[model samples]
Target chain A: MAPSDSDAIFSALADPTRRAILSLIGEHEELTAGEIAAHFDSLGRTAVSSHLRILRLAGLVAERRDGRFRHYSVTPTPADAVVAFLTSVYQNSLEQLASAVQGAATSEDTPAGRVEERSA
Target chain B: MGELILNNELRLEACPSELFALFGQGDAAVGWLFGSEAPLLRPGSLVRLALPLGGLARSPGTARVLSCQPNRRIDLMHETPWAGRVVCRFDPLDSGGTRLRVRVTIDDVEVARLGAELGLLGGYETGWWEVPLGLLISLSGPAGILGRSTANCAQLAVEEINADGGVMGRAVRLVVGDDATDPGVGAIAMRRLCRTPGLAAVIGMHSSATYAVTAPMAVAKGIPYLYTPTSEPTAEHPLLVRFGETPMDQLHRALPLMAAQTGGSRWFLAGNDYSWPRAVGATARAVIERMDGHVAGEGYLPLGSQNFEPLLAAIQRSGVDHVVSSFVGQDHVGFQRDFAASGLRDSIRTFAPLMDDAVVEHLGESGEGTWNALGYFVALDTSENREFLRRYSDRFGSCSPPVSAAAEGVYEAIHTWARSCRAGGGVEPTALLSGLRRSRFNGPRRCTLGGSLESLLLGEATRSGVRVLDELPAATQAS
Candidate 1:
C-alpha cells in the first residue's frame, strides 16, 4: 500500500465506535452485521454499519457474503502498512540528521578512513 | 543486556520491491556485503560475510538467516567468532521512493566492535559479554589519594567489564600509569601510553594542567583519550573526550541556591592561581554579578600555599561573609583545617566546588559546616549508586578510598568507551572516535555526555554528610 493510504486508515481509526467494532471483528474470525450491532447496545444498526463501511473503505476489513447475510473480518494489510509507514517516517528523520552531520563533517577535514578493506 | 539496535535510513528513488531485490538476490548483495561467489540469503540458510578489518580479524564469518519478510524486513544472526545480528527494513517514502533502514547487533563483543568500525553504524547499548579478544586499555592519574581513588574506580570498571565478558568478547587489561600530580611526568606517562601496543584507549583523572599537556599529545598520536575530573574547558580535539562538569554547569545551578540559603550577596573569591581556578573564579564572579551580588574580595594563592593565615586575615579584614574557594588536592585539605582553626568557621559560609567525600572525610570535624555543590556525591542514594557502591565495596572493601564524582567519572568513561567500541563494530581509532560521538547510556551517578557537555547532578554537603540539592537538567551540544 502507498504511504498516503495511512491517512484513510487513520481517519477510520479516529472514531471510537469504529475502533471498537474493528477490535470485535478481530476477536472473532468473522462477525455478521447483526451480531456486531448486538454487542454495542448504545449504537444503532445504521450507525454500526456506517462505521463498518468506513473500515471497509480503508481496507481495514473484508466483507464476505453468506447465504443471506454479510460477514466482516479484520484484514492485516492496513495495520502492516501503517507500521511500515511509521517506521519509514522515523527512519527518514534519522537519515536527514545523519546526512546533516555528515555534510558538516565533510566541510571540515575528512579524517582518513582508517578501516582496513575486507579480504575475499 | 538486550541486543543493541542501530538504525540508519536512506531515501532512494525506488519502490520497496526494487530495494528488496537488491538484497533478495545473491549477486546484488555480493560486493556490498556477503562477498561470496554464490551467497545464499534464504531464511534458515547460512551466509558468509567478508570481514572488513581483515588483517586484524578472521576473513569470512558465517551467519544464519533468522527470518525474511519479502519487500520489508530481513534478520540475520551471525555465528562467527564475534556473533551478532543484522536487520534491514524497506518502506515506501512519501516522495515516491523507498526508505531503507539497516540495524546491526553483534552478540559477540569482539565482532560487534569490529563491525562498528567498518560501516555507517553508530553507537548503541550492549546486551551480553563474551571475551575471546583481549583489549588492553591504559589509565593515568595522580598517585596521590584523589588520583588513587580515581584509579580504583577504573579498576572497578575493568572488573565490571570482565564480569560481563569484556567488550566484543575480548578480555580487557587496564594498565595504570602514575602522573604523580606533575604535568611534566604526566605528559611523559601519556606519551608512553600512546606508544603502548594493543592499547585501545586511555582514561585519565589528573589535574587540568596534566590534561592540558597530555590530552593534545594523545590526540596528536591518534590515540583516544577520555579525561575525567578536569574542569578547564577544552578546545575541540578529534581524539579527546572530557568527562567533567564545566564551571558554568556547576555555578549556574549551585550558586543561586547557595546565595538564597545563606542570604548573602557579598562574595569572596579565593583559589589557587591556575587555569582551572582562574576559569572557575571567573564563572563564579559572572554568576554572582548576574544575581545582583557584589564581590567583596578576590584572593589568588600559589598552588602549594600552606599559609592561609594571611589569606584568612585578608578576608576577615575585608569583612566578606561568603567565600568561594577552588583549591584542589592537599591545598584544599590544608585550607579547610586552617580556616576551621581560625575561629572564622562559625561566622563565614564557605563553598568549595571540588570538595568530595575524601576531602570531607580528611577534614573530619574541621570540615563541618562547609558546603560543596557538584555533579556527584558518595552520599547520593539512587538505586544505580547503591548497586555501584555495593559492587565497589564488595570488590575493594569498606576501607577502599571514598568514591568521589571524579572516580565515578572514570568508571563511566570506561563503560562509555566499551559501548563505543561495540557500536563502531571495531576498535580502530576512526571507528571508535565516531562511535564515541554517538554513544549514550546511564551509569553510576548517572554521569553522561548527552551532547558536548557532560550532564551534571548538583548536590550540597551538610554538617553531617552530603545531601543532593538538585539535579541540573541535561544540556545539548555546546550549551
Candidate 2:
C-alpha cells in the first residue's frame, strides 16, 4: 500500500519550501502561484509553482482550474494523521533512547546473496 | 562440484547435496539432536515435543520440530522458547564458498502479537545469531555494509539504539566499515571500526577481508566481537563468539517439514554467484537426494544478476513444485519480484530460508501471499511479540519484520549489546566483547541463561562477518 494520506501529508511537510507555501497560504488565504511568489524574496516564479505542485500532491493544498491558471488552497485533513506520524517519528527516537538501557543488559552474537550480472 | 562415492558414502569436495540429506522430519531431528535414532514418529512435518526433552525450549512441554529440504540453502529449523520456528540455509556460490541465510516465518501470528504487546521486544530477536555471520560472509568482499542493504539495516539499528538512549547512557555506536561486499573494503571497514572511538564493540566482516584482518583488529582493539556469522568452524575464535549453527539447528527441522508440507521432493535451486550459495548448495544436494528427491535443476546467476528468466524457465520445464532460492541483498527483492511476476507464481511454490526483514521490506506487497517457509514470522501469536510488532510498527513505520531468528536476533542483540555496554560502564570495545561473552540474556525466546537470547545476540554481533549462521547444521539450536 502507498503511504497513508496523512503520512504523505507529513512527508510532504518535511520540506522547507513546501512548508513555506503552507505558511504563505496561512498568512494570506488561498493565493495562487503568482501571488505566493511575491512573498519570497529569492524564489523564482517557477520554483514557487513547483512548490505548490508538491503541496497539492500531498493533499495539503486544493486546486481549481481558472482557464489557463489554477488557484491553490489548503485543504484541511484529519489532525490525528499529523499527530500519529509525528508520534511515530519521535517514538523511534525514543526507542533509540530506551535501547540505551537495554543495550547495557548483555552482549550477544547475530548476524547474504547472489550474483546477477547486469548494469542499471 | 566434484564428488566420489567411497564405501557407499558420497564424499564430495563440498557436500552441496549433503545439506539436504542431513535434515529429516520429526524423530529425525529429535534423533539427531539426542544422538539417537529419532524415536517412533508419526506423519506431519512438525512434531511438538516436550521442552525438557527438546534442545531449545521457550516454555515447558512443547517444541515444534520442523523438517524439510525446502531448499538446498536452508539447513536447519527449530523451536524458540516463544514457540516460533526459524529456518537457516546455505546458498552455494557460482564462484566459490556459500551465502548463509536465515528466516523465521511467523506461523503463530498470535504469539508474535502477544510478544509485541507484552513490551518485551526481545522476543523479536530470537535466533538472530546467524544473521551477522551470514552477512559478513556475504560481504566476502563485494560491497561493505555501507551503501548496501546491510549498511541500511545497520544504520537503522544504530539509529534505533541512539534514539533509544545510547544503550544505557553510552552511545550505542557501531564501528562499521565498507564490506562493499569486497575483501579489501571489508578489511578497511574492520580496521576503521577497530580504531573507532566511543563505539562499544565491532562484529561482521568484509569479503576477502578474512578472519585474520577482522578477528585481530577487533581483539587488539579490545572491542567485543560478540559473534561472527560465518559457517566455517567457529570454535577456534575466542575473541569472536560463534553463533553460526551447524546444519542441524533450524534446517533439520525446516527441510523435512517443507517436504512433507508440500509433498514434493524434486528441487530447483537458484542463487547468486558467490561463496554462500556454493557452500550451501554443496551441503543441500546431499540431503535432498538421500530423501529420494532429484535435483531437477540447479543454476547460478552473477551477484546482482538481473535476469532470472532462464532459471524460471528451467523451473517450469523441470516440472518442479518447490523452488529453493538462495538470493541476497538487492537480489532478494529482484528475484522475488521476478518470482511473483513469473507464471509460476501459481504453479510453483517457492520456499526460501534467506528472507530477512531488510530483504522482505524491499519486497513489500510483492511478498504477501507467497507460500514461503519461515523459521519465524513477524505475525506469530505471542504476547511479547504482539507488543513488539505494535511498538516496532508504531516506532519504525509499518514495515513488518521478516519472521526468523535474525530479525529478532538483531532486535535482541541491540538490547544485549546495550546491556553489555551498560555493564561495562564506559563500554569499550574489548571490554564489551568480554562482557557479552560472560553474559547470557533471558531473551524474548524465554530460554534460561538467555541461551536463546544468546542465539539472537550472537547473530547480531556476528553481523559484520561471513554468513556462517546460514549453514547451521540441524544439530545446533537457540531455544
**Candidate topping TM-score:** 1
Candidate 1 stretches with Cα past 4 Å from truth are A1-120, B1-143, B447-455, B462-464, B474-479
DockQ, per model, reads 0.01, 0.01
lDDT of 2 by residue, B1-479 (tens): 21111010111123335333333332322223221122222222222222221113211111223343433533122322222333445455453323333343323332332222111111122222211211232321111111222333444556666776765454443433324333333343454344333444554533212554566666676555644232334335545654433323434445555678678888787877666655556555766776777788888886546677887787889998777676655555568788787867666656554554444444555554333322334444457667655555565333222233444544455556665555656465545555564555433443323223112211111121112222222333433
- What candidate 2 gets wrong by more than 4 Å, as runs, is A1-120, B1-171, B174-178, B205-222, B228-235, B244-248, B364-376, B397-407, B421-434, B445-474, B477-479
lDDT for predicted candidate 2 compared with the true structure: 0.44
lDDT of candidate 1 over B215-315, digit per residue (tens): 77777777777776748677877777777777787777567777898887888898888788889899899989999998888888865466798898988
TM-score of chain A in every predicted structure: 0.65, 0.64
B132: Cα error in model 1, Å: 15
